[model samples]
Target: MKAAEIRSKTVDQLNDDLASLKKEQFNLRFQKATGQLEKTARVKQVRKDIARIKTIAAEKSAGKKA
Candidate 1:
């Protein structure tokens, strides 16, 4: 998913998306360990997406605190 799309989501939606991405990341790791992962690039993409979501979430929280 694009950062713009992710940023448009509400915090609750972002949390849900983050959770699902984490789950997918876990499964991808196992697949990689077993040499079954066809789309290795997906792992990198997911990691970046997770980071983006966390960053956005932190920004949102900080905005609220301010």
Candidate 2:
């Protein structure tokens, strides 16, 4: 998801999204370890996406506080 899209979500939604992504990341790691993952690069992409979502969520919260 884009930062703009992420920023548009409510804090609660962002938290939910973050939780889901983290779970997916964990599953991906397990897949990688078991040699079941076909696309290893997806792990990196998911990590970056998770970071982006978190950064945007933080920025939105900070903006609201100011």
Candidate 3:
């Protein structure tokens, strides 16, 4: 997902998205370990998306605090 798209989501939604991404990341790791991961690039993509959500979430929270 794009940063702009992530930024549009509310904090609660972002949290939910982050949780789901983490679950998917876990599953992907299992797949990789078993040598069944066809789309290995997805693991990297999900990791980046998780980071994007987290960064935007932090920015939003900091904005609120300020």
Worst 10 residues of 3 by lDDT: 3-12
Across residues 1-66, which tens digit of lDDT does each residue of candidate 2 receive? 777888788989999999999999999999999989998888998899899988888888899999
Ranking by TM-score: 3, 1, 2
Pairs of residues at least 3 apart in sequence or in different chains that clash in candidate 3: none
Candidate maximizing TM-score: 3
lDDT of 3: 0.97
Q: After superposition, which runs of candidate 3 have C-alpha atoms over 4 Å from their true positions?
A: none
Which portions of model 2 show Cα errors greater than 4 Å? Answer: none
Over 4 Å off in model 1, which ranges? none
Total clashing pairs in model 1: 0
Question: Per-residue lDDT for 8 in model 3?
Answer: 91
> How do the residues 1-66 of candidate 1 rate in per-residue lDDT, one tens digit apiece?
888898798999999999999999999999999999999999999999999999999998899899
| Cα RMSD for predicted model 1 | 0.7
Worst 10 residues of 1 by lDDT: 1-10
Give lDDT: candidate 2, residue 24: 94
